[model samples]
Each structure stands twice: as structure tokens, then as C-alpha cells.
Target: MSLRWKISATVAAVSVVVAVALSLIVHLAYARKQADDAHRLQAERIQLLLREYHRGSQPAFGSRLDDPAVPADLRAAVRGGKVATALRQTSEGTFIWAAAGTGDHVLSLRSDYRDSLGDLAALDRVLLLGSAAVVAGGTLAGIAIGARLSDRLRRAATAARHVSAGDPTVRVGAAIGGRSHDEATELAHAVDAMAGALQARLEAERRVTADIAHELRTPLTGLTTAAELLPPGRMTDIVQERTKALRALVEDVLEVARLDTATERPALSDVALGEFTTHRAAALAPDARVVVRVGTVVATDPRRLERILANLLTNATRHGRPPITVVVDGPRVTVRDRGPGFPGHLLRDGPARFRKGGDRTTPGHGLGLTIAAGQAAVLGARLTFANPREGGALATLDLAPAAGGEPSP
Candidate 1:
């Protein structure tokens, strides 16, 4: 049943019970009062009989009792004119019933008469009708209350669901009643407060990330092209080094952009990590030392995989004194640097794009670790940064194998 009806039914039921109990009490009391009146009226007869007997006129009055052997004490007492309170006998002169009372209250019971039971049934019928009326009235009142409450609750629930699904514009329609006591109204206010905070955070982050990307990309592109055009023989190592830094900056910006926008989720596939590493090593780190420890397979997109490795290799070249070893085991790939270890906190946030490099002492934009970390996340992998006991930072990407696939290795 609807909430309104259910609440009304409960209220009605309780009212009915209480009403019936009260009615029964009233009826019982009324019946007892009636019996008392009957007893008082019968007491008149006893007084009259005592007066006559005391005058020596009705001496054999005790012989008519149902218990023909009336109690000797009572008979003697009645025989005397000094009877204080005498027992009553039925007017037929047979002791069918008796009672003793001085006023309106019946204090004693009679053996043969249930003087009140007959009237009790009539009172009971009246009590039943009164109870029904009370229940019906209570039910109507309860329904009104339940409906008001349910309406407010339903409005709050609807607003909550809307906000949960990311529609910040949805609002609770009207006040349930007064602001002083409306719980749903208060809840709606709370939701509005919370939504405003979330929206602000999201907008601020979006604006900042976009502005930073715009500021960095133009100069980076120019620097990369100019470096490439310079005669390597004349510029020597300078051109290569400058171009590498510029390229790293550009890549980092792109990684941030891609991850920030939800448009590029990876197309997962089972690719053998060992095989993928072999291709990457051949293309980028051909002359550099490299090793694969296991033949594990991981699920990921190839293009995103290359981006992940490229950042790792670039970071190693820039800061890690590598001799890099790339290995695969189970569902993971380890990119180890045999260089001076990561500066304490790099492992914590995995690398934020602009926060690294630029100190004359450190060579590249801190973007390398950041880019790798972001891409790894997008492709369903966790990049763990750990300091090996031996030395350097060991970065691992734990990946999941594709569904319904073989070990590609």
C-alpha cells in the first residue's frame, strides 16, 4: 500500500483498540452503578420487615428462605427490633437473592440473581458503535498526516537521485512546509550546498589545466623544430639535448590533455609485455642495455602502451643513469632506473606535469614521470614507484590480461 494508507491504517487500528477498551470500562462502570441502585431499593424491604418483626408482627418471615435453615444469628438479629443493617430477601418472600448496603453502593453479592448482566449486553453494543466511529475519524486524520510526510520525502529522494547522476541543475520544488520543521527541505538545502562545492572544484581544475597546456605548447613546438634544423655537427650535443627537452615538454602536455578529457579510453587487448618491450627497445633504446625477466601478458592498447614506455625511457635518459632493464612478470612491467634515485616525493604523486625539472641542476621537465603515470592509469594500470634496496626508483605497471584471451607472450 501507499505510505499514506499504511500510516492511516496503523493509526486507525490503535485508536480502535483504545476506544474499545475505554468503552468497555465505561459500560462496566454503568452496569455496576445500576446494580448498586437495585441493591439500595431492596434494602428498603429489609428495613420494613425488621420494623414489623420488632413489633412482633412477622415472626415467621425467615421460614420462606431458599435455605429454609436460615442462619440462626441472622434470624435472631432480625427477630430483634435493633437490627443495624439487615440482609435483603426477594419480594416473593423466598430468599432467591440478598444484598447488604447502607447507601447507593452495592457491597454484598446475592447467590441467585445476576442483576447487572442483562443491562451489560446493551451497553456493550453502544460501546462497539462508539469505538467504530472513533476509529474511522482517527483513520481520516492519520491519512492526511502520512500524505504530507510522504510528499516531502519523495521530493527529497527525487532531487537526491538527480544530483547523484550529475545533474546539478535539479532542485527540490517547494518547501514541504515551514523551514523550522521540514527535514526534506533541509536536506534539499544541504544538497544544493554540496553541489556548488563540487562544481567549483571541477571548473577550477579544468581552467588551470587548460591554461597551462596552452602556455607551454607553442614555445615547445618552435624549440623542437629549430633544434632539429640545426646542423648536428656544428651544434654537437647541444641540439640533441635541447630538442629532447622540448619534445618531452610537448609529450607531457599531450598526456595531460588526453587524460583530462574522457574522450580517449583505451581499446583493451592482450599484448605480451615482453614483445612490446622488444619493439620499444629497438626503436628508442637500441644501443642501451635492456632485459626482460618474464614472458607475462597484459591487456592494453598498443598506441597508449608506446606512450607509456616512451615517457619511462625518456625519464631514464634524462635523470636515471641507465643501463635500464624492462621486465615483465605475471601482469606487470617493471621499468628500473640504475641512476640516482627519485627525489623523495616523486613516488607519492607519480609526477605532476610542470612540477619537475627547470632547476639548473636537474635536466628535464618533471613531466616524464607524470605523463607515464597518467597514461598507465588511462590504460587500466597502476604505476607503483618504489625505492629498491640496491638503488634507484623502480616503476611498475600492473596490468590485467584481456578477457577470453591467451598469454600473448
Candidate 2:
């Protein structure tokens, strides 16, 4: 259940319990008071009868008493010149009897209180219904309040998710009910501040990286030219190799900067995924295996797709064992390599720019998978890396479906 429903239910349950308890207490007290008043009135009537008999006025006994069913103990007490009262419950219902002595006879009176009992029963039903109404009103009020609060929380949660998914512009404004100083508003402001800080820091880093790469490109070109002019020797070969490595690193850094700023837009078009993957694999690495299970076309940027595939194939060849396999099923592509699999940290957190995997002594600068992930994001696809239980590294890219069109045959 949602938090709104849970809160509403709790409030409603408590209201019902309190209403019922209060109603029961009031009804019990009223019933007791009614019984006490009936007894007192009965005793008063009996006293008046005894007084009348003593004065020899002799009022009719049946006028003040009904049935006059007196218990033995009560009759003896009245005959002994003491006033007595008794409550009896017989097959005919409840009665209150009071008696007192006047000369040799006991002046006794009895009252059938079944009508008063009926009134109490009617009052009980009223109280029960009133309590139910009270409970229902409270429940509705609780639901309204809970729904409003949960809506505010849901908006805040959505903003947090957008921030997590690399959109820094999303902000969870003020609280839904417009309270300025509440906890929900405070939380929203905190999240906005955090997102702003992260965006600023990341942009600053990207600027620095892009500037450094741009500065190195000129020197790197000159260095390569100078190495080519050198005499053929071991030193020239070493210089050429180092220059090539530096050039590759600079290019990767520039690409990462571009991805960070999202300066590239996908030129989406329907492309046959199976044929495309086969051609790219043949050109990039003819030795690798390619398999098409469900050959369906997808709408995507062809250049970006090739970049993604190239990175995955290169990583497989460089870091993993042979028998690299590429499989396409609908808008999903899976690349599996028989290797030691990904490191634990990479599997958990995905790829980070310049974060190298495998042995530290490896030649590549570790931006291949990062570039692939960035390109996939640009094409509206999800790229996931995992070490399958079958003991190999698996990279799956799930692309968006073709735009309002069936897959090409």
C-alpha cells in the first residue's frame, strides 16, 4: 500500500476506536443515571403512600402500585418499620419495588421500568449511529490530508530521480500545500542545491579536460611529424608508439567532454540491426563471431551505433579472451566475451570516464566503455554491463523502438 493509504487507514482506525469507546462510556453512564432516578422516584412514591395510610386517608393501593410483587426479606423489613427497596428481573421484565410500614400493614409500590429501558435502547442506537458518522467523517478528512502530503512527496521523489539520471535542471520546488518553512519544502530546496552543485562541478571538470586536450593536440601533431623525420632506429619506434598513445588519449578526452555537455544530437533513421552489426563486426574485427537471433530494424543514429559497437568489440579483443559474440534481438543487442569478466566495482556502478579495468599495466586508457555508454544515452538506449552467471562478461544495449513503424523485414 502507498504511504497515503497507510496514514489514512491508521487515522480512520483510531477515530473509530475512540468514537466507539466514548459512545460506550456515555451510554453506560446515562443508563446508570436513569436506573438510579427510577429507584429514587419509586422510593418517594412509597413514602407518600405510607404517609397517606397513617393519616387514615386511605388512598387506593392499586393507584400507586402495580402488581406489588414484594420479596420476603423486603416485606419483613417494611413490617419492622423500615423503608425497603428491591430490584427484580422476572419473566415479565424488570421492576423496582419500594415498601414502608403503616400500622400493621406494609404499604408497598412496584414500578415496571421496561419503557425506560426501551428509551435507553433507543438512545444506544442513536449514540452508535452518531459514533459511526463521526468515524466516517474523520476517515474522509484523514484521506484528504494524506493524499495531499503524499503528492508533495511523490513530486520530490521524481525530481531526485531526474537528478540521478544526469538531468541537473530538474528542481523540486516548494511544498505542494505551499508551506514555506515545512520539512518537505526544506528537503526540496536541499535537493535543488545539491543538483546545482554537482552540475557546476561536473561542467568545470569537462571544461578543463576539453581545454587540456585541445592544447595537447597541436604539440602531439608536431611530435608525430618530428618522429617521422628521425632516422630509422629503436628510439624513433619508441617515440612513434608513445606519440600514438598520447594522440589516442587526447581524442578520448575530447569525446568524453563532448558527451558530458550533450552537444551531440542523434540523427535517427531506420536501420536493419542484424545486417548493420554484421558489417561493422567484419570491418572492425573479422575474427569475432556474430549471431542474429531476432533480426529486427531499429531507429537510431548509424554513426553512434557504430561507435558503440566498435568500442565494445575493441574492449572484448583487448581485455577479454577470444570468441567474442554479438547477438541482435529486436532493439536489444548483446555482446558476450569469454573472459575473466568485469571487476566487481564496474559491475555495481557502471562505467566512469578514465576508469580503467583489467590489469593496471594494460595499454588502453579505459574510456572505451565510457564513450560507448555516453553514445548509447544520446541514442535513447540503456547500456548495461554484467558478468553473466555463465562465466563471461555480457554487455547489453537496449535501444528505443522504431518511431511509429514496424521493423523492416
Candidate 3:
């Protein structure tokens, strides 16, 4: 059940218990008071009868001489020179019987209490209705309070989700709606504070990375030129290959930092989706298969799209078994490789730079997907990764949002 419903149920249960308890107390007290008053009246009537009998005069009402209608227990007790009373439920109705001993004769007086019993029944009905009203009122109040609290919590939860999705700018703030010092308000403030702190730390890390990449670029250029000048031999070939790899790594670091800082702007242009994807995949991996199901035109940043595709293609070639397949349909491009798909952590957390799996056989750092996702964001596109049930890693790049509309296929 939802938090709102749970809270409402709890309040309703408590209200019902309290109302029942109060009704029971009121009913018992009223019944006891009425019984006590009836007993007192019976005692006074018995005394009046005894006085009349002693003065040699007959009492007018409720006076019985040797009444056989009295209960055997009451008759036996009263004959011992004592005044006693008993209640009996007979076919006539409920009645109170009181008797006293009078010179080998029993004097008795009984009052019909059925009317008072009816009054008690009416009071019980009133108390039951009142209890129902109290429960209903309490349930309604609980619903209102639960709705207010649950709404605030829902908004806070949404803001937390946005932060987890890498947008630290989203804040719950005072829009959550509650007293300034209330727990909900304080929770909103805490979420905003956490987002702010995260953004600060991310900015600091991005600045340091960008600075380091920029500093390495100049020396890498000189190193590339020096390696090219060496004699054509095995040793020179190794040096040039190593130099190229190092340069690529430095460039990737710089690219990721730029993506993180949101410094690169997408240069939108008209591109033929099928032709572009086919050509890029063939150039990157000549042995890979390129399939075009339909032809369409789309407007997007070609440079960024190429970078995203290149990273996906490179990751597939390095970590997966080929032949890779690149499929283009409308504004969507999908790259698939027959391999041990992606890891569970990658699927769960999306992509993070520098977070490579434990497989040392793979020949690149884990920035490929991160860079692809970042470039997709810059181009206003959606990129997703998954391990297909058919047993392969699949990367899909959807450019529909950025393309505005797919041109006629």
C-alpha cells in the first residue's frame, strides 16, 4: 500500500478503538446510575409500607400481603427480618422486586422498569451513532493530512531521481510546501544541499582533468613528430605505435572533460542517415556487416554522431567477437556484436569514465560509452546500451528528437 493509505488506515483504526471505548464507558455509567436510583426508590416505598402497616392502615399502592409472585430467593431472604430486592426477566417484562418481613407476613413492592430500560436502549443507540460520526470525521481528517505529507515526499523523491540521472540542478526547495521547520521542509533543504555539493565536487574534478589534458597536448605533438623522424625498423614502428596510442588517450581525456563541462556545442547539419552509417562502419571495421533497412534524411551534428559511432565500434572490436553488424533505420542507428554482452554494473549504472571491467584482455579504457552518452546529450539525442537476450551487446543511437522529423524514406 502507499504511504498515504497506510497512514490513513492507522488513524482510522485508532479513532474506532477510542470511540468504542468511550461509548462503552458512557453506557455503563448511565445504566449503573439508573439502577442505583431505582434501588433507592424501592427502599423508600418499602419503609412507607412498613409505617402504614404499624399504624393499622393499608398502603394504597405497590403493597402486597404474602405475595406468591415474588421470587423464592427474595421470599426466603425477606422472611428473615431483612429488606431485599431482586431483578427478574419474565414474559411480562423486566421488573425490580423488593420485600420486607411484617409479622409472619411478607410485605412487598415492585416497580415496572421497562420504560427506563427503553430509555437506556435509546441512549445506547445515540452513543453508537455518535461513535460512527467520530470515526468518519477522524478518517476524513487523516486522508487530508496523509495526502499533504505524501505529496511532499513524492516531490522530494523525484528530485532525488533527477540528481541520480546526473542533473544536479534540480532542487526540491520550498516548492515541496510545508512549515519552515517541518520535517518535509527540512528534507527538501537537505536534498538541495546534497545536489549543490555534488555539482561542486564534479566541477572541481572536471577543471583538474581539463587542465591536465590541455598541458599534455603540446608535448604529445612534439613526441609524435620525433617518433615519425626515426628510421624505418621494428624499434621505430613500436615507438610510433606507442606514441599514437598515447596521443589518442590524451585526446579522449580532453574530449570527456569538455563534454562534462558542457563546453562543446553541436554543429547541426543535414545528413543522409543510411549512407553515413554504412560508410563510417565500413571505414572503421572493413570486415563488419552494414545493413540499411530504409533510407531517410535527418538534420543533426555529424561530427558528434561520428564520434559516438566510432566509440561504440571501437568498443565492440576490442572486447567482442566479430563480425559486428551496424543497422540503420530512419533516424536510429544500432551497433551489435556477438560477445559476452555488457556487465551487470554497466547496465545498472549506465556509463562512467575510467570505470573499466576486470577483463584485462580488452584494449581500451572504459570512456567509450561515457563519451558516446555525453555526445548524445550534447546533440539532444538518446543513446542506450543493452545486452540482447539473443546474446550480444547492443548500442542504439536514436536521433529522432534532434532530427525534428525523418525525411521521406
| TM-score winner | 3
Candidates' C-alpha lDDT? 0.66, 0.85, 0.86
lDDT of 1 by residue, 1-409 (tens): 8887889889988998899789978987896676666556555655554445447643334412223444445444443232223234455442323322222222222333444555677778878888888898998899888888787777777776776544556765443344555666677677777877876786578667677867777877787777777775857567778767666565566567666554457887778777787888678776555566566667788888888888777777677776787776756777787887776767665576667633447766566677677677778678878879999768787887766545433
lDDT of 3 by residue, 1-409 (tens): 8889998999999999999999999999999898888888888888888888778756547688788898999999987678988778899988888888877888888889998799999999999999999999999999988988898899888878877767655788745766657888887888788788888999999999989999999999999999999999999999999999889889999989988876578888878888888888888888789889876777788888989989999898888888799988878889999988888888998997878766966777788999999999998889988999999899999885334555555
Off by over 4 Å in 1: 1-202, 208-244, 287-293, 357-360
Give the range of the ten consecutive residues with the poorest summed lDDT in model 2: 59-68
Question: How close to the true structure is residue 328 of candidate 2, measured as C-alpha lDDT?
Answer: 83
Q: Which candidate leads in lDDT?
A: 3
* Root-mean-square deviation of Cα positions for candidate 2 versus the true structure, in angstroms: 3.0
Error of 3 at 156 (Å): 1.5
lDDT of 2 by residue, 13-89 (tens): 99999998998899899988988898788888887777776777565565342235677878787766778788888
- Candidate 1: the clashing residue pairs are 321-339, 356-366
Instruction: Please identify model 3 stretches exceeding 4 Å from their true place.
Output: 56-59, 262-272, 294-299, 329-331, 401-409
- Please give the TM-score that candidate 3 achieves against the real structure: 0.90
lDDT of 3: 0.86
